[model samples]
Target: MGSNSSKISDLPKNEYLKKLSGPESISENDPFWNQLFSFSFPAPTSSSELKLLEEATISVCKSLVENNPRTGNLAALTKVFLSRTRELRLSAECQNHIFIWQTHNALFIICCLLKVFIRELSEEELQLHFTYEEKSPGSYSSDSEDLLEELLCSLVQLITDTPLLDITYEIAVEAISAMVVFLSCQLFHKEVLRQSISHKYLMQGPCLPYTSKLVKTLLYNFIRQEKPPPPGTHVFPQQSDGGGLLYGLASGVARQVGSSFSW
Candidate 1:
């Protein structure tokens, strides 16, 4: 038995690290999981540092979901990440401009991980997970449903809550484009249409109003060179030659909404 224990201890470092980090070893009370909530990437001066931050973020998200499956642990982690992102956004506003890029990178990475997590579930599982509704007062609420709602709400807040002038134009466009991509996810699309949550959280939330302002801003800038297009004609401008980021994001949002209800 002692020799067997010695053999197990002699396992490769990578293998041991994998075991230690596996979801099975994770718990709601674990310090490692708590640390993930407070984890902040240092200002990345090089591509390598940025890459490390991205990898670490993804690994934490992946392990949480994989180990905990549909448990409250995953939901808690989702909330933590979203809260941290919001804090980072506020920090970026007051700090150096480099933090804006860092926040953008972090948001993009989180969205990518969310997309992967959604795609990993089967259609039936997706439906079951997302379609769940709260029943009795004392009944357990579905963690999957909470996770999905929190993610969508976080994206909405990220785009709509920030002051227009504080966020870079590139970051604004990227956030909008990311929102479009997230809404276009197969499971998310179906849920929004069937449940009408999109109308509640997006179409009527802040996107339409924000997009309208964006259109006006873009048109005003364009009018200096040439006459603006017809009032309604440019509602969702195409990204043709010389068209800008606002146009591209507007087109993406329009396409996403149109496609959601068509099916």
Candidate 2:
């Protein structure tokens, strides 16, 4: 228990967030959480280094999630992570290898963070408090719909544009595991998910593969919940009563969108 306590205390504190906004420029010497968002800080230069960083950062975040880190801190983490994902949308002209590497890294980060935070949410947190200032930690959730949409959009483009990127298959599967954990949360409301079927991107001929894959995943998860727990090392949040309703809405929308392209 003491070891877990040590890990929780290392989470990015309010003081560091303030310093991030101050005149002093951030350097690599700063904490990993702060450097993660710094423009000047060096991103991991190799796949192995990124894996190492993911393990370290996620180990800490797992502690924070279990111990209930402050809402403000959790909010800051989500905002910075989401901000980086926008870069993925704009890097279309880059070389294939470069684009693959960038998407791989982004998906890794997203998968790690989701797997950490998508645990069973309390009934109270489902109300969705917009303000994240100091208050009962149970009053909010950082699972933004924007994050979910960005993830789906990026995956759509990748699978449609480069079906042969075999390396991406491993990471994409990892992301699916993390994403399914959200099925029980209130975050899967129809409005936040409607674009999967409605986006012009899906109407294009090339995007058919992703649309089909998306539907299959939803249906798989729907059946998956009723079976024995999946046999994997990945930790899943305990299923809640609300998960059934949320999965119904999610599966329906995904199926509705895929029907036009389903073989």
Candidate 3:
């Protein structure tokens, strides 16, 4: 154990980051996972240190997405990673840790990476990526809601429950950006997202700290996502009714700008 510690400590930071982030295969047994799971801190305080840590997290996640081009393989890996967030208890509550994402930017990094994959991957590639798979004719091991929705709720908690500033502030803005991605891509679970944006926590934010940027992101995406019928033909209404709430969120933020309230 001491030898392993010395080796990890002796390695230059970039080399360590490169090792895991490189084309090299990083199994769960890799020391990288051990290090992430072992490191404990109340919040990420070191800018250079945590920046490299967060970057490493992003690299692994992106590699996972890129490596698993097949839908079946991606879904399998996606379910495992999402489930880890819950199993190890990642949330906005701000407790200290033994889990992989307990550090400051880690959870936010995960949220952002997930947004990238969800937006970039094809719909069919991700349909089963959200939740569970059946083992038999009619039985699933669990009936829990989509893990993606669970993570979305966790983002809502971070946005609403935590005071955004510094790194946390940056995280909040980016989290809203991620939510916009979910909206434009229309890849979210309806009921869970409704739970995320319900009137209960609208006061938490998407205003002030999140005001103009949030509104602009939503509005731009809303317009970009628009699909008018050819020439003068009437279009059918959306069956899934996916993104209406997000549009309302944009209008909601627009109404809150320059309110003269301190965040």
Candidate 4:
């Protein structure tokens, strides 16, 4: 068995991909899927190898998203990938520029997948997405809510923990913009507004830390830049028309702050 496994592992990258991309659908319980889940890329010894590994991972992710037999399994896999990519980004050991670039690329792909998943969700599913078990004793599980919180927390860490010098301005803008779009969702926005007024808090408990980090980063960058954009320039590329996502985000955050200070 060990010899056979070694032989399989030694297969060329193209062969490996061909095998994995074969017509058989991937079930969560399938051995092939499990093997892929457990597979870790060896640390790249060269820039070329790093690029190859990154491309391979992207290919595999696209294939899984397309061919996975279960939505739940795909969601679970996405969560795992997001968590791993976050860990990699945050790791002090992962300081290589190529590695960091690859990590960001992986994050971009994962975010795209997440966007597609959210876009396809029905209104009923969207409602359920925000429902989570209360922290109180004997409360029913709210796995979906838990997952959402985890993702938010991860994004915050990704935004805050990564050094500004290391990350591209475009990626930084997109990350914060994504958060803004998420918070702007009607259901999420109403819930946050209610929480702010009733509980005397601006953002939800899980989102507060990230929100603070985001504000700090934005202010810091704005202050430190040699030349700032014109007064009305949008922070993100897609927000050129109106106040843009950043303005909306700032307003939302300011409201939260105001609620906090209200007597």
Candidate 5:
């Protein structure tokens, strides 16, 4: 332990240091997950410092959702990160970390939200909301209304903050689709087909019945409105993009949702 402490202390100030700080270790009842802010990213000058700070502000969002049980925190964290009021212009080095964090964590958050949303749908609600074909075979495990709202709120913020223009629509599509796949598998349960809805809905999020439609509409409308990409423009393979730091979260949610239902 002493050697580990010394190594951590001896480590140079850099974005790498920021990564070491980790998702906060929380007990079952911490009330709020304290924001982990480590000013370890090296900034040689005042300007560099500002940039690093901005990147940190953007990059630290995942810590809020690392083990979050409520969707509200995830939504709130997204708002905080994307707030123009708090926007930080990142240094090139810091930007790399920010990008890496986003690549890994961003989509993960989405997946988690989806799980919460799907889980939130009550057994009766799921049965009612979904058609016979859409219905799974069992009961949902629990009841939590706030989950979907929290998820959609976060998703909206994510879309608004990271515009399709900056990150590109391809990345967004792949991220959402990946999230869908993940939720369908991980959160599935035998009871979900017929019994009371489970706590999974407590996390999947708000959009739900609305989200599926909203997403489809948005994807369709965007495609209809935009000019076509030039032929032979070399559309990049989305898999290489590495869904960002948030991918695990979204993937985790997807796993949950997929486990529970068909779509």
Candidate 6:
């Protein structure tokens, strides 16, 4: 009876230790959390581990975005991990499980994190694209290339061209960060992803095969520098031949010039 009582007495402490040691508890407040995040989202040079981290990141984003708020602000803080519409869908899914106000507040917090984490790749890593060399014969197999290509394609798809209601700047930044990391790791080499999809097939869609908003932002901001139109270059056509209208006809067409035209 005493042995059983002692074991029972130790149970609570055991549970406490488990919580303290687990991956879930490693947060910003914990000194170890940075290490965990870095390890989990390491540059792609650590291919095996990076692959695991990528899968885990996507799964967490899907779950938190879709249905899990008891997890607290972690999900909220990770909101930028998903694009805008995704957050909306996730919030709707979890509304029944959490207070609407809490969900809304959490979403704001998540967007802020995304905004901060993305505009942060170093210049050295950004330039890695130029130094890329073809893989030696046995280095990367065709299958590996295919997977990388698919991921690249997905990244491209996330970037949207919607005029006004597309993703926010914060979400765009996060997407850029993700692409920079992928580039730094050399995941999308010419021999790998670029070759997997033909130039023709890739340019067909409204968006590219893997064109994500994040990827699009990455391309514009990083891969291809979007220089402003040359100095003194006016984008709009010089006020037409009619001084801001086809002079008389432009103003008279809508009004009735002589007939008081009523639609």
Misplaced by over 4 Å in model 1 are 1-21, 24-66, 70-73, 96-102, 120-147, 164-174, 186-193, 196-263
TM-score of 1: 0.46
RMSD of every candidate to native, in Å, equals 12.2, 14.2, 16.9, 13.7, 14.6, 21.7
Total clashes, candidate 2?
A: 0
Which digits, one per residue and each the tens of the lDDT, describe model 5 over residues 117-203? 344444444222222111133322244333333433444434333333322343344345433533343244544443223324423
What is candidate 1's lDDT per residue for 43-100, written digit by digit as tens? 3323343334334445544554444433434444444456555675566478545555
Cα lDDT for residue 121, candidate 4: 49
Pick out the ten consecutive residues of candidate 6 with the lowest summed lDDT.
254-263
Candidate 1, which ten residues in sequence have the lowest lDDT sum? 1-10
Residue 51 miss distance in model 6 (angstroms): 23
lDDT of 2 by residue, 1-263 (tens): 11122122333442443343222333323354433332212233334433454445555555445333333444444444445434533443343334434344444444444433433333234113212433464544454443334444555544334332223333334344334433433343324543332243445444445778766654654565532222221112223444542243343334322321221
- Which 10-residue window of candidate 4 scores lowest in summed lDDT? 1-10
TM-score of each: 0.46, 0.36, 0.37, 0.46, 0.32, 0.24
- Candidates 1 and 3: which is better by lDDT? 1
Q: Give stretches of model 4 more than 4 Å off.
A: 1-71, 85-94, 117-145, 167-170, 187-202, 226-263
How much lDDT does each candidate structure score? 0.44, 0.38, 0.38, 0.42, 0.34, 0.29
Ranked by TM-score, top first: 4, 1, 3, 2, 5, 6
Instruction: Give the distance in Å from residue 237's predicted Cα in candidate 5 to where it truly belongs.
Output: 2.3
lDDT-superior candidate, 3 or 6: 3
Worst 10 residues of 2 by lDDT: 229-238
Local lDDT at 81 for model 2: 42
- The per-prediction tally of clashing pairs is 0, 0, 1, 1, 73, 14
Judge candidate 5 at residue 222 and give its lDDT. 47
Residue pairs clashing in model 4 are 133-142
Per-residue error (Å), model 4, residue 85: 4.4
Which is the winner by lDDT between candidate 2 and candidate 4? 4
